[model samples]
Target: MEIATPMATDDRARFETLLSRHRGIVLKIAASYAWHAEDRADLTQDIATQLWRAFPGYDPSRPFPTWMYRIALNVAIGHVRRHAPHSRLTVPFDEALHDTADDLTNDRDGLDRMRLLQRFISDQQPLDRALLLLYLEERSSREMSEVLGIGESNVTTKINRLKQRLRDYAAAAGHD
Candidate 1:
């Protein structure tokens, strides 16, 4: 076993603080990729471990959330790819639907819409799913480009295409 130095202890404290502050990002990505609760937990752990390993190299000048998102998304994409044949993609939205609406009919409508949106997201390839998640989070095009390692123009184009696809899906589902 290795003894911790002062520098190492400081780094550990910093890492824990950062991770705690942005824990939701990890959980969101894991939920989007992992259909089962156990799988989500495992993916969250995997992401945290990878983040810790990469912490020493993290640039203090840049935004921490963006860096965290990049690592978390990569891990989630990898998890989905590795389990592709055995699992389906899912995201948790039940609470969102149940908590927002006051009327039963409105709740039903929200649930239907949520399910449609979820299906569209689940049907996407992992990279596209990541793009959609970033887009939904209101991340700027440049930031999305940085996280996805794509050009800003490409990010805009993909967002347009995704919007069109969602429209088409809604139309086909009689929600247009």
Candidate 2:
């Protein structure tokens, strides 16, 4: 009684590939938002789900990782929107649907401040997260505007504001 199940296999392979490449960054981003240890896996799952959901929407002309990053950040924030920010989130995992939110969050050291940075990062809209990631990666504002569908001036203004936001977080956290 052999069955021909192609879709499941394809989805699993796609998930494994994307997870292998982006899990670290996704984990980092999730841990930043979640304030507990138990939540990391949950949040990671959220990111994975979001990626899978957004996979079909991916554009070939655009860079894969950048597009993936957009999906990742968007899913993370969407999780927060659905679940309370401080509590551990538990959403049904679907390699197909994507996005449930993070469960990990613990910043025990100065290095942990990166999580807080993610908090600030995820605070913005998906487009803003993409913009900031590009800015941090040193992508030019013109390029960011193109990717984000905004004017370059808007990119500059947003960067200035985001930087200030990060600085404010650092100041409050005593990291700066």
**Candidate whose TM-score is highest:** 1
Off by over 4 Å in 1: 90-107
TM-score of 1: 0.90
The per-prediction tally of clashing pairs is 0, 12
**lDDT score, candidate 1, position 126:** 87
Per-candidate alpha-carbon RMSD to the true structure: 2.6, 8.4
Give the total clashing residue pairs for model 1: 0
Candidate of highest lDDT: 1
Clashes of 2: 12
Model 1 per-residue lDDT tens digits across residues 1-176: 99999999999999999999999899788878887778888999999999999999999999999999999999999888788888575565454435644543456777688778877887888888999999989999999999999999999999999999999999999988
Please write out the lDDT profile of model 2 over residues 34-94, one tens digit for every residue: 5455666677787877777767666757766666655666666676666665554432222
Model 2 poorest 10 in a row by lDDT: 92-101
Q: Least accurate stretch of 10 residues (summed lDDT) in model 1?
A: 96-105
